[model samples]
Target: MNGNVPASTRTLRVLTFLATQPGPVPMERIASAVGLPRSSTYHLLKAMISEGFVVHLPEEKRYGLGVAAFEIGSAYLRHDPLERLARPLLAQLVAEIGQTAHLGVLHGRELVYLLKEQPPRPVTLVTDVGVRLPATLTASGRALLAELPPAQVRALFPTPESFVRRTEQGPQTLTQLRRILADEKRQGYAVEDSHITPGVASVASAAVDHAGHPVAAISVTFRTDAIPSSERFLLARRTRQAADALTRRLRG
Candidate 1:
């Protein structure tokens, strides 16, 4: 790595550092971490704050990655080759499973839908692109949750009181959530019924990124009463294959 990069490059590096840190990082800490002069660090921070890449907390006097950072980070999804590359795969999964397919990323304890493929049948689902759903109440959420560390999961939900039950079937507490995630991990995917909408069942698998983190989930939703016990295995297998294919595309 070059010790002396241009000012523009240094500013970019500072933003990168703040992004990877997860939470607020103080100006002095940023200076020390990036090995920049205090004056330069302050100037860079001020500029980034103005540009919305960083936010300054007047009360705490600490700096954190801002909404602009989140937007910019999410923008990567728009141009992401994985989503484009995975569309046909999602359609194929829906075709094979005879159910709706969805691709969602975990966003601050929520599942943000990135893409969805609807089945051709008369009965369909409402997992439209760009819709956000509760991560704790959906199979896709559980599938992604299964890959996260217990501490990270705890940090995401904070408390049992924060858990919102969408239906009688959903997990009502953190203990229940942890147990569900553990089961999903053991089973290699997550399965849930009538959690989001009564009479609907879903199964999801985690789509991992290059870091081996569960970046997203691929799910299939169908009418609970319609899916036979014999077809459940096929649905799970096809959903897993879609997730695996998406992960491979993402890694490439």
Candidate 2:
């Protein structure tokens, strides 16, 4: 209701409203929704259109987000501080667990490794910084995916072909993936045994943001038999603790 607010704040409000819409909206609706006067909203839209953050559809008499908005979103993904904040935590996790630890973020249907830390005497692992793996086959990927809405998960894996198998040990269909994700959601963490690499096991937890959306996952991987079955739960608890720490750091 304050008409004298800063331009930057009002602009951000307008953009946020537009982002929640299913499609383009008319200028009148945007102005009413964002509580801006028609004239002021028009001016803001004009400036945004000129800057390529909004596009005006003359034929439909509506406005929609433009390429610049998408670029900004992409930039946020690229510049997110997740890696820098999780680096030392990953190192500590590996030291405590005596296994290789990794930080991964979901990229479409894949999980991209952004950081990896190994113990003083570590086992060789296929997971390395810059490596990408199928989301359904890795604990890191499953951890991130489990936090997402089911419809979003469905969108990410539309067909059976969307499922990629490294070994014959993981989910190969939507139903199976959903089952695995359900178990993860209930357990508060995810696990993969010989999915990405034979004789290797990984346990992971998602690092969520202020909005409770997962921004990344922290995982620890080791030989299947390196840790006894009874103690594996302790490793998972430690991984989840590390993930929660990163989440707190991000929210803080």
Candidate 3:
């Protein structure tokens, strides 16, 4: 076995620790967390900072994620093969469910709608492609959160103050959000009704990577009263199926 760690492994460990930590971590904290010598950690940090994957806080002398990290993430969306594969599947979802279907990815603390498929109906939905919404308040967000490790989930929204409600039904605190994610995990889907708009409801499930991290979520949004009670589970199941198919195609 190799006695020394590779530079790639060291950088990954540092990034993962920073991601899981609640806030910007100091150089010392990163060194302790990644089990690297202080001098080596500083050198690694300097290289990462130069590459734009990490940023240093001049005021607090701490480090946080930077723009280049987001570019790497945006690359996932821009170059994704899933979108091409998902178009036919999402079209089927829209046709069968008689509602709009969406594919959303979690970006930082927000869910960005990457694609929106509207059914051939007289009424149209307000949600469009490229819309951004509060993740803690959306069905797609909850589905993604269900796939996250618990500690990372907590770090994403550390306190009640971290939750920003776009509507009255949204979770009001970290405890409440935790409970929601738990329920979503148990049920294998997430439900959001009247969170963004009155009379609107959505149910979703995640598209997970090979490591079981959520890459995105598939959802169906429609008028709450228009959907029959018996069909709700079916809709949820369809969303999950679409998500699973997309994940398999992407990860495999």
lDDT of 1 by residue, 86-197 (tens): 7889888877766788888777677888888887663656567888888888889889878865545655665777777667667777788898899888988899787888
Q: Best candidate per lDDT, number?
A: 2
Of models 2 and 3, which has the larger TM-score? 3
> Any runs in candidate 1 off by more than 4 Å, and if so which?
1-75, 78-80
lDDT (C-alpha, whole model) for all candidates: 0.78, 0.84, 0.80
Candidate order (lDDT): 2, 3, 1
| Candidate 2 structure quality by residue, lDDT tens digits, 94-182 | 87777899988877778888888988898988888889899889998999889865645765676999999678889889999999999
Model 2 backbone overlap count: 0
Worst 10 residues of 2 by lDDT: 71-80
| Ordering by TM-score | 3, 2, 1
| C-alpha RMSD for every candidate | 5.3, 6.5, 5.6
lDDT of 1: 0.78
TM-score of each: 0.72, 0.74, 0.76
TM-score of 2: 0.74
